[model samples]
Target: MGVFRFESKYAAPTKEQRERYMRGECEEHMFGNDGEIVLVLYDEAAYLKDDLEGVRILFTGASDKRKVDDEVRRLLEEHGQKEQRPDEFESGKRR
Candidate 1:
């Protein structure tokens, strides 16, 4: 299994959205239009872990790193959030 991480400034997901995501009903966007930095994992079980700082999602099946990364990027884009570059963190510009 592989794990991919992404950062966002969006709000945390609502109860309903979280429920849907846990059931593997959210294909286009994990937390609908919410959630901050997200961690995507390829695993056998689908799971969602949400908190104040970020969210973590375990996909239902294993997938290539590229595919997982692309899906995360797409989800971020859909929510109008951009992944921060490493330099941003180094410069202390991350939010």
Candidate 2:
């Protein structure tokens, strides 16, 4: 089995609040990295809400780690989501 990844959820953007996001008025969201993985979580509630509702799921994995990348890619495939390029912004990949 591959090494399990740890959780590092920071309410870093908590101050930004969720109102701006739902209204599409957020000047900017926040991003973070789990190793080489990059993630932009506008609102934790919204993110988890979308994921739980099957609307969308933003998966992040270490770009340079084979096991992590493969695992994340597999999840995307299982969820019927197209794997997004690391540095490129695809239509459904980002908000």
Candidate 3:
């Protein structure tokens, strides 16, 4: 299994709060690999079912390890997000 990174302004249900989502009484949105949101509605059981709104299920894969930074930059560009300098000390600071 791959690590799925979630980035959304929307709030996520906590473990204790998941019951509402699991029961399909709440709505949630997840980001696709392409960075687009796939709207989903939860049932009383919160299990992703056929009733889940938006684009039903989306199959995704791991972000390219070598190209992840570049890809994120591209996405930011599309959204007019301000350019950020790469962390210059990150690699050197790691012990």
Number of colliding residue pairs in each model: 0, 0, 10
Which regions of candidate 1 fall more than 4 Å away from where they truly are?
A: 1-35, 40-56, 60-66, 81-95
**Number of the top candidate by TM-score?**
1
For lDDT, the strongest prediction is 1
- Put the candidates in TM-score order, highest first: 1, 3, 2
TM-score of 3: 0.23
What is candidate 1's lDDT per residue for 1-95, written digit by digit as tens? Answer: 43323233344434654454345433332444455434533224333344433544444344533355655566556445433333334655668
lDDT of 2 by residue, 19-76 (tens): 4333342222322221222323332222321131123222222332233335444544
The residue pairs that clash in candidate 2, if any, are none
C-alpha RMSD values across all candidates: 11.8, 15.2, 14.8
Predicted candidate 3 versus true structure: per-residue lDDT over 50-83, tens digit per residue: 2212222221223322333344344446434322
lDDT of 3 at 10: 38
Clashing pairs in 1: none
Provide TM-scores for the models: 0.27, 0.22, 0.23
Worst 10 residues of 2 by lDDT: 44-53
